[model samples]
Target: LNAAPGWGTRLVAGAVVVTFMASYALFRDWERFGPLLLRHPTLLALDTLFGALLLVSAGPGSTLAYVSVCTPFLAGLIYGWRAAAVFASLQGLVLLLVHATLDNPHTGPAEALLLPGLCVVAGAAGSSLRQLMLRFTEATRALTEMRARLAVTEAVSAERARLAREMHDSVAKTLHGVALAADGLTRSAAAPDIDAARVRQQSGLVARSARRAAAESRELLADLRRESDPGHGTDVLAELAARTRDFHARTGLTATFRPTGGPAVPPVPPAVARQLLTIAAEAMENAHRHAGATRVEVLAGVHGGLLRISVHDDGRGLPPGTDLEQLRRTGHFGLIGMVERAASVGARIRVGRGTRTHGTEVRVDLPLAALTATTREA
Candidate 1:
């Protein structure tokens, strides 16, 4: 995943890391009894299988005794605790039988306890190394995303800076010319003739209207590229958290806010963010005030290139017929305002029953396209 960023490669990387760590448990004094195990092909095969299973077992302090434990530990890790437990039981039975049947000097009860005591300290080191590698990979992915966002931000800033500069020059000049024309018209209104005065006044009014339209267009563009306002300039997740806390405190209602997708998402435009937050706040407040809700939950995140936000409450729900049209009759403009805000941002809002409880759920879903300046205009 670090290289190709695909799940196939990611799975391969995971397997490789797991194997590398699993190999640390394979180091035993295999050279010492090579002949005896080799002479008996079956024992040799058993030894090989034992070594394989050793990778999964958790040994206290020694490798030799707990070598048989690997199969169960690995089974548990791969197939879950039940499989691990079953494999461990079989391994323990075989180990006990082997030790008891052997008449060799190594056949003591304490010798049989080796699997229980194998330190497997090397495995811990392997686990730590694996964790470090995974963390580094995550950091690298995050860095890549941040770099992409930075590039987009720089490009946008440059464009906005250019537009702002052009607006200042062009609009300023237009207004300046209009002011000069108005001054000249007022001074020249003495006309010296009725026809000249009427013509000048009509011409001046047309010019004023034309200038006003140009000024309005400039204002629209200016609003698009405006500087960030105080609170909305910060992170959206943090804003949601603060809002959840404030709601709980202000209304004495239980409120929880959580983010999905990932820890850090790309920044949202300030105006859109503000409207979304306002809609969220409004939904939550209405739930508490009108729905008699005691608990509220809000989720905000961009998933599948679509921004999704949901505010759900666990109190009384709306009638089954409630909808955009039905809402107009009830005079509850809270839902209407939500729909309007979402519509203004080129979003789609859905109102339904809350999943947490049988209350109201106001969900606003905005396509990524809707959040852009071009789509906003459309």
Candidate 2:
């Protein structure tokens, strides 16, 4: 495992160094020491061989004999600083004792002590170098992770801003147009030979469109509010049902809502809330104006960490547009807006006629990741 700061590494490193030095001292010439090699055979072999080679090639008189200092350096390189220091100190003690008792009886105490004393310094130096490298590596790793997280955050934030702007231009503007159309139809009723039947039909369409627009506006506003104040955490199902009821009350149309297994309080972030509200409102509006529907149904559920909102209206369905962009520019802009919002948040919206409803059905599936970004802001 990477060297995490914990008691385990300290204990293991300490024990390895202490046991290795102790066993080396206990059995300088025992065959049993070979089995102890199984614990950390490579390090044990290297240290022992280096010490033996120095003893053979460089006599006690030569300063080059101190090349055996590599034993502690190797321990530090493999384990860490603390272990390296302990191993170096232990090895130096063993050398001093061996030279005093068996190898250098003719030499003065100070002369015999010089090589072992240098070994102690070399061990400490090795440990310090390893610690510095380890610290640098950890710092670099942490910095890289933080930068990657920041990049994702920035991209999500930018997407949210673009989505908000599009909703204002498309959904909000369409609602404004519907409100104007309703007021105009009501005023024109004062004129004679006005084709009352056609005017009433247009009035109904205008009223329905206005209601959908208002609901969309409210939902979008709620999302914006959530960004600044997350205290009003709405239940997604309740909000959908409430919007449907308001649609019925405003337009004198029959609208129903059914929800299947969702959280009492929507776990959606503010960004998703905005996009979901936009799609639902747009779907309802299209049904009211173009489909001439008397009944509308809103359904909501969760699937695969996504919130799916569906709006179905029972009215005469229109043909799919050949030039979606041209239609949007003329007046039917909400569909385009809804699609863009879904894309911004890594979601998808499906628009089709309902099986039983005999009118348009728009379904939006919003990803949970879009909401996760706003949750932090909240």
Candidate 3:
């Protein structure tokens, strides 16, 4: 079978042919028939025959006879070493016939055989070069596959780490608080001179804590299941509004959602959408459980190529000099987790005093370009 040679083989063949033609023109006078023999179609169709004829015309002792080496070299590159050897043998037989006819004084049998020997050497070198290129291409393909596999492993590891952090920040913390309240209630009940009012209050606190823990567990499980379900065709802003209403119903807090700047927010990938939802949930949770805010407003808008989402509560703002790093050091992982979630999706997060100066605002800003690119990839 005839295989197409690589560009490198073609380039070498071109250079050799150019040099051979130049040498032939310099060493010998060109006849009118030379033009016809050098035509593109004739050269392609009778490449080996042309080389054999030129060698016979030049004779064994001439400098131009060595240029015939290109015929076998090109054959090896295109059709392997066996085809090259056959071409070289044919040229050698033509040279033997020419030498026997001419019987030139300067050219012996050994001198005639030398030209074919050189052609054989050139052919073997071309075959070795083609083999080297094949090996290199195979190696490059293997390396690319290995890198793709490594990237997938890294992505899986990062996802697992994110899930572990989510569990620690939400359900685990809620259950720990419930356990502490239950223990306190048990000790109060064991007291011989129990104050009924204090015991009843402790019982109520334990029940509420247990219920909150159960709710937190359910929400976490729901988030985990949603990761695999790709049918989330609902707009993220609408979902955020629903979450605010649910928060108000469950906790009796006055939580509201308002859209500003534009009527719609551009769509984002599921991974980015999930992170944004979790960040908003954490912000509202912190306002309800820690800030003790009676009124909470969730604002979402697109402004100057940025998708901004902010949760503002008319509660006690963050303590003086408190930042994400300080919160992490003090074991308050809720806000830290929110920041991590924002960072995971290439968004920026901030927590500070609200516009009222007496409340807290947790805000996340994501680039519109990021949303568009993620949507296209999804």
Candidate 4:
């Protein structure tokens, strides 16, 4: 397309050359020479064609020098590097041929021959310059793409950090309170001269709080599990048994847990494990505190593709018309926490006045889907 300007310049130069020839013919012997060449048709044709070629080649001004330089640049713009080089060489050949038969004593044949070489050099330079520009443009585009990806990655990282902070503030605080309450109750139970009932109540409170703390602690850790290794070690059934043993050791409450079925580790998601443990702890605590119970039993197994966890205590049953809501509200963290955790994991948790052994019973039945096998393996 840049060749467009050079072509226009050549056309204007041709028109001016035509005007000059017209004026020169009027004042000189151009007519006499024109008739002499006509007697020889071949010579007349050659002379006329050479005059037209000269006019067309002489671009916008009398300076044919400027035209020689511009032709190659124009060729380079229109035909890239290789074609531009060929055009430059062709222009020199045309100029040499035109100068050969022309009688006008303007420039020498050697000068006409040098014009094409100059065009090739200029065209090559233009090609090199264009290549450099393209390379720089490509580099810029690549940098822009990299920067956009970097921004997206940073945004995701920041969002994860914010979520971690929120988890700490909400779940972490609640768990801490429960743990402190357990420690307080445990210390209270160690006092001397306390009645049996009072001692039992205090011990029960401690066990309940401890269990809630453990559950919450597990939950807090679950969110931090690796994406590639999304599993928590230790089976849920084994965890229940371990907690029961720990409770007995700590409070001398005689807590016992058994899995009724084959040694299949029932799938248990982290949320389900937390809730079931909390519920068991709450059930046993209520029996010991309010019912003066001596034995607590925890039964855990899988039934019909569901995880069943039930806690039964041989303590006195809950009082008639007991305000279960009020009981849950008055720092009975176990009941409320258990329910919340169960709901989170889509488990069906029930706490009622009586079950086997005529004591308070709490049971949680969770769907197999809610209890992930990956979590159990973890």
- What is the lDDT of every predicted structure here? 0.62, 0.67, 0.71, 0.60
- Ranking 1 against 4 by lDDT, winner: 1
TM-score for each candidate, following the candidate numbering: 0.39, 0.45, 0.41, 0.39
As a whole number from 0 to 100, the lDDT of residue 342 in candidate 2 is: 67
Regions more than 4 Å wrong, model 4: 1-163, 166-223, 226-228, 231-234, 328-333, 353-357, 373-378
lDDT, candidate 1, at 279: 88
Using lDDT as the measure, name the better of candidate 2 and candidate 4. Answer: 2
Over 1-378, each residue of candidate 1 has an lDDT whose tens digit, in order, gives 122457655654564456546455433544654454335545433543554333223222233345445545444433444444455555665555545544567456676755533323323333445566678998985674444344334434554565568667777666676776666666566556547856667567758856775876667565554434322232567788899899999989999998976534545665566667888999999998889988899898888766788899987888776677777887878889887776655566888884644888988765554334322231
What's the distance in Å from true for residue 78, model 1?
Answer: 34
- Lowest summed lDDT across 10 adjacent residues in model 2 is found at 144-153
lDDT for predicted candidate 4 compared with the true structure = 0.60
Off-target runs (Cα >4 Å) in candidate 2 are: 1-67, 77-81, 101-111, 218-377
The prediction achieving the highest lDDT against the true structure is 3
Tens digits of per-residue lDDT for model 4, 210-306:
6765676575465445311335433678888888888788778888898975547544443335456777777766767777878888888878656
Over 1-378, each residue of candidate 2 has an lDDT whose tens digit, in order, gives 222368755754564456558757746855665455436746555665555434443345544356467667756755677667777776676566556545545788787787788777777777777788889998985564444334334535774586689688868788788878877787678667687886888788897887777777787776667655655544677767888888888888888898865553356554455567767877887778778888888989877656778888878875766356776778867778887776666666787775654677888775554454445556
Write down the worst ten-residue block by lDDT for model 3.
148-157
Task: Give candidate 2's whole-model lDDT.
Answer: 0.67
Error of 1 at 147 (Å): 28
